[model samples]
Target: MCSHYEPVITKKQLATHFKVADLEDGLKPELWPGYIGPFIRKHEYADVGDDAVPFRELMVGSFGMIPHWSKDTKIARMTYNARSETVAEKPSFRDAWRLNRHCIIPAQAIFEPDWSTGKAVPTRIVRTDGKPMGIAGIWTGWKNPANGEILRSFSMLTVNADDHEFMRNFHKPQDEKRMVVILQEEDYDGWLSATWQDSRQYLKQFPAELMQTQTEAWTTDLP
Candidate 1:
């Protein structure tokens, strides 16, 4: 499961890479469970006749899922990563999953702890081609009692990575290896428009060869 991740993707990257134009305010550069971040969801302009309307809209939301039934946003801390196997049954994630509230999280890279050397070391993971990743997730809206403000939040879907050649190397040797669901560029549109029955098909792990990891020595960002 992810503790936290840096979604270093900028507004320009969101436009060109994800083809997103309808956007909300920007979020922090890095995101913890309760921090704000950007996510892409399929939206219809309420018109099927407009061929030029953008199908994808970028919006700001908390990294962790804040279920509608929850009393507070505190639930976000523990609901950031939804397990793939039980996502449909989990109380916090089931609503979004069943309603097809799928979304795409644009991330330039993700940080995972490498515990291979008897000590934890922060490591960076990125696509081999140096492109931003479109991570799969589900979103929901919660009404705050204190201010009556409705805020959107989401959770990243994760799958068992124990057998994955690259991802399996992270985390503790004794712990279960898991990774975020990374969707292919070609499947971006299809994924956001997926129904509950077809959503599970997109939770597979990304190919290991197409991804590479770097220890805590990286300097320059991807161009």
Candidate 2:
């Protein structure tokens, strides 16, 4: 799973990809740790907005999952990604997963470390079709008890990539292989409103055939 990723900063995520309306709080070009980014969840009747929106609603959230019990926002640094196998049991991620607070993190690409050269080399992994990837995730809103300021946050869900052909090529040679769960475009609605049980079906790997890679390293300073 990637800790640093390029979010869907353009309108395609809502206008064509996810098909939502507003992109509140805007979005960041890159998300690392607590950086703000847009995530889409199933719209609820109680949500404040025009009643004419589609099934999904886009929102702004910190890249890391912030738990209700957290005293501050620092916890986000470690909760940026959740392991699918134990998501339902980890204290910080259990609640969101159990409640099925599912969301899709639209990303232009995700950066993974390629260690084949005996050193970590940053590599960008994107869909071969050049469309934004709708990554399966869980979200929650943490209210700052000091001032009652509520901040939404999310964590990308990931799976074991030991058997994955493309994903297994990234990361360390001795470390466990892992990759984020990328949902097919047609499954966007299904994943957004999925129950905890049904959610498991989408926590799988995206086919390598549909992906391409960038071997050149990039820097946030210039991006």
For model 2, the superposed segments whose C-alpha errors exceed 4 Å read: 46-53, 215-217, 221-223
- Candidate 1 worst ten-residue window by lDDT: 214-223
Alpha carbon deviation, residue 45, candidate 1 (Å): 3.3
- Structural RMSD, model 2: 2.4
**TM-scores of all candidate predictions against the true structure:** 0.92, 0.93
lDDT of 2 by residue, 149-191 (tens): 9999999999999999899999889899999999999898889
TM-score of 1: 0.92
**Candidate 1, 33-131: lDDT as tens digits:** 898888999874714767787788788898899999999988999999999899999999999999989999988888888999988777888899988
Clashing pairs in 2: none
| Whole-model lDDT, model 1 | 0.87
